[model samples]
Target chain A: MTDGFVTASGVSRHFTPSLPLGERIVAAFGGAVERRSVRAVDQVDLSLRKGEALGLVGESGCGKTTLGRMIAGILPPSDGALAIAGEPVMTCGASPRKTTTRVQMVFQDPFASLDPRMRIGDALAEGPIHHGLVSKAGAVAYVRDWLGQVGLEPDYVSRYPHQFSGGQRQRVAIARALAMRPDVLVCDEPVASLDVSIQAQIINLFLKLRRELDLTLLFISHDLGVVRHLCDRVAIMYLGRIVEEGPTHEVYADPRHPYTQALLDSVPKLVLEEGAEVRFKPIQGELPSPLAPPPGCHFHLRCPFAAERCAVERPTLRPVATGRRAACHFAKTDLNIITGSSSSPAVIASGAKQSS
Target chain B: MIDRASPLARFFGEFRESRAAVFGLVVVGLMIGLALLAPLITPQDPYDLASLTLRDARRPPGYVGTAGFTHWLGTDAQGRDLLSAILYGLRISIQMGLVAGAIGLVLGASVGTTAAYLGGRVEAFVMRLIDLQLSFPAILLAFVIAALLGQGKWQLVAALVAAQYAYFARTAHGAAAAERHKDYVEAALSTPLPARRVVFRHILPNALPPLIVVATVQIASAISLEATLSFLGVGLPPTEPSLGMLIANGFPYMLSGRYWISIYPGVALIILIFAVNLVGDQIRDQLNPRLRR
Candidate 1:
């Protein structure tokens, strides 16, 4: 494994179910009920290269957000090792203050992410001032500058978060994260809650900030189309495990795992050709609960080409091609292929690439 | 140069629109004014021994006595003008209420914030202490403390403060705990701020509004407790003549045709408590935006 800027090796997080009143009453009869554990993220190893955007795509219940939180130091990894810039992140008694300054997270709901009571200026200055990145007056200037950088007017700084639109609040949240001057910015579905038109604006703003500030990004989203446009590399997560990982173009062009292929087929694409009707098929069945994830390859139950071996033996992530990785047994074989006759440039360009 | 059209101004504008709140404010303002102007507004000094005459004692309202003009509210058993005694008593009651409320607010806020910020054992310990204090009735707890310390203004104030601080602490602790989970507080923590600054400056301001409402309501409760303690003969000595003492001294003569003795001071106490409660209600209405709508 090369020394990428941010790395998580076999990281896992488990949450114990808190004993409710009913559970406590049941336990009083000398019968102990086993507490359930939710394996949010399991045995995941990946590296985010410096100054590159990594998109982590998964369904709602998948551990993409949990993995993002682990990287951001909001939730510590329950097992395995994590490092930033070759420095270890997960340790028994490490200072969280130091780790938090290195990486910041922009949450899914911009409104929920920002404090309603705080003014935009105070919200932006809080991180910078606390981190000793700047003096009080200097932090004010930094806040104004970052607000400007995020396409918000400097004059809007004095206003409260509720006074701003949803997109503007997200921009303020971005400004707050930037105030700390972190090396990596983990965006946990930053634009998932925004309007379609506003999503583009926020995405463009993120791209602009990433380029200008030389910031590494871990962008998590369920929307593959948004991920395809913004990320340099994409990782498809299913049932708390990354089913496939590759460069954005390669992964979307030729998704090795059946789950990845299904995800790609599910995204609605615009057919520019006259008289061409593009058919969209949504993924079948509901997501399995994290508490009792299936044995062997977690996706085996949902995979179209699941063999007996897939149900019995868990497949580890292995190199399928150059800069491409997949956890399926039949990586070489294109088991499931859904083709459309649209000559859209995106599809043509992506189809030729074959590795993300 | 504050903005006259700012959101705070708009909030106040909305506050004034509430008839209950406005009426409450007016009543509180008048009571506070009466307390402040006790000396200038009243002709007779409540505490002066020479001015008091037993000959005019327990006179009814509007009765003209031999000693100058009799008060419309008449006199108490001590011949102290009921109106003058009330004005003076209001001054003492207001002073004790404000002091005890301030002490409770400070002590409770500090303890509550510390407990909420440093959870686990500390939270359990502090919350248990609150529970212990709450389990015993507030007036009973005040009586116990007053008995232990002996009777004095400070003793009564101390008892009232102890009784009230627990409520403030519980409210502040809950508010601080809620604020602690908010993003702004986490954002502050992620910065280089020392834990104290994060807890005090950033977390405290946001947590205080709810506590402010609690404090306002507690002020009325504390005053009532003080009056109760005094009425029971464990608070302010006879010479001091607080509203509670006056009410206590006049209660025996209620059926003896001297209705003015108890009625005047009772009305004054009720008015003061009512005014304070009204103001507290207004504060609750104003501070909570959810209530306004």
Candidate 2:
């Protein structure tokens, strides 16, 4: 991960909720003052090589969106160093501001992602014209080209956002980002809001655009199947921290982290044999609140193979094999804990530790 | 589902759908025209003391003046023609409302949008000030300001702007703050365009519909506020009599069976406000997405 193209090292984004007037007055009279900060993204290290697609997979409130936002230079990190191709993305000061234009983001909701008042052509051309990528006179043609690239009609440029369907709006959003000539594209569940048929078409568009533009992509989603299909590498997040990261095939085949193993096992599998019964074992335990995450491992309460050390000591993300990392105290141990039987898709194998 | 017309044309297209709004628009246009043409069309210059005669004072409607001109709406204590007084008053009242409303909208919308976009302590400070100001009655605030900066056209305007700006600030802050968190705004910010551009070009456009709705209603309020101040004798100077002053000047005669003095100007004021409010209501309904159908 060292010397990668897009790098975020030791990044942390903490947000303190402001107390309302009544609460402040109550606290002034010696009432219990609530001052807990939400650690949305805490001390995370991630690196994406140029032209490589990294899938950031996690359940809701796992901070995948916040991480993607920071990487795309939309939200400034509370603390960390983020760089794209050796150029710092955020300017350091009392209030950090995003300084780079090398990255752009695609939001999950197409309906809200576009300005309703602006015409499609104007929305797509706004960034390019401001950045001097195209002249005002040339913006129409530039916007049309980008629109066509995203499989939208050039004539659709004259319309407002409300005039388009969910699928069409997402296409327009992609074109708007691409018009900025961004080297890195951060898609935060771009197709999650679209119809199932539309999702496949948009996914195909992303695949085509990634190859054609040779772009470094950060695909953030909770859908494991989509991430597995689209991403080359996958990083699993739990309570604002990356717990495991590796090539998609290796991690899906043999998940070292117990959390990752449980997540994979939770996915329903198809049985082709006659009279084959399928049992769905959902991961046990609720996701702890990010406001006050468990002191040690965030996944300890949910991990089937959680040891005594897992509850007390925080496990750093350590190398468990070539091109793989897992944050678990027993990740490299010979503790054979069978969370599911052989019929279960994910059988915990202590054999990965031997390779390390 | 696409309309190729410009936004202004589209708004007008939608505006014409309501018959009452159209009638209000026509009445408003007619009033503005009457005010603008008052100097050439009025039979008398109401401000010219030399043209007045004390014998013509307190005449009932349709009385023949000594100058051989019929006072269709009668004369006040100063014998100034009520019709002429109202036309001139229209000019002053409309101008005060528009000038005050425009200045208030721009000043307060900027303050509010800036506060919302640059949130945290700045927002808290601006919002608190706005809240404190809002807690006071608008007319009371205007009265206080008018009392402090007494007896002039500009003074009343200043009072109206000061009194009404908090409403604009509150409205703009709410609209812009809601818009600031929308995905479009975040997407605009991610484009790396300057923050100023994002605030004005992106956030402001979406926030403006509500501000515009506020502006129309506020303009009507500003006009009424000016009338109230003038009636209280703290508004426009005697040299520049407005509708409220005319109504106030004629009030004493109302008990003496000479009702034309105050009644005519009061009726004019009501018509103007009614027309304006009608237009404002239609615009509010039109802009609200829930009532669009």
- Enumerate the candidates' DockQ scores in order: 0.33, 0.64
**Residue A201, candidate 2: how far off, in angstroms?**
1.1
Minimal lDDT window, size 10, model 1 chain B: B1-10
Cα-based lDDT at residue A32, candidate 2:
97
Docking class of 2: medium
Could you tell me how far off, in angstroms, the CA of residue A192 lies in candidate 2 after the best superposition? 0.5
Candidate 1 lands at a TM-score of 0.90
Give the whole-model CA lDDT for all candidates, comma-separated.
0.81, 0.89
Q: In candidate 1, which residue pairs get closer than 3 Å at backbone N, Cα or C atoms, i.e. clash?
A: A130-B191, A130-B192, A130-B193, A131-B191, A131-B192, A246-A356, A247-A356, A250-A355, A250-A356, A251-A356
Candidate 2 off by > 4 Å: A20-34, A270-275, A332-356, B1-17, B289-293
Tens digits of per-residue lDDT for model 1, B102-150: 9999999988998998887879998998989989899898898998898
Worst 10 contiguous positions by lDDT, candidate 2 chain A: A339-348
**Residues A103-192 of candidate 1: C-alpha lDDT, one tens digit per residue:** 887888877777766677887887677667889878777888998999999988788776788898899888888888988998999999
For model 1 chain A, the run of ten residues with the poorest summed lDDT: A334-343
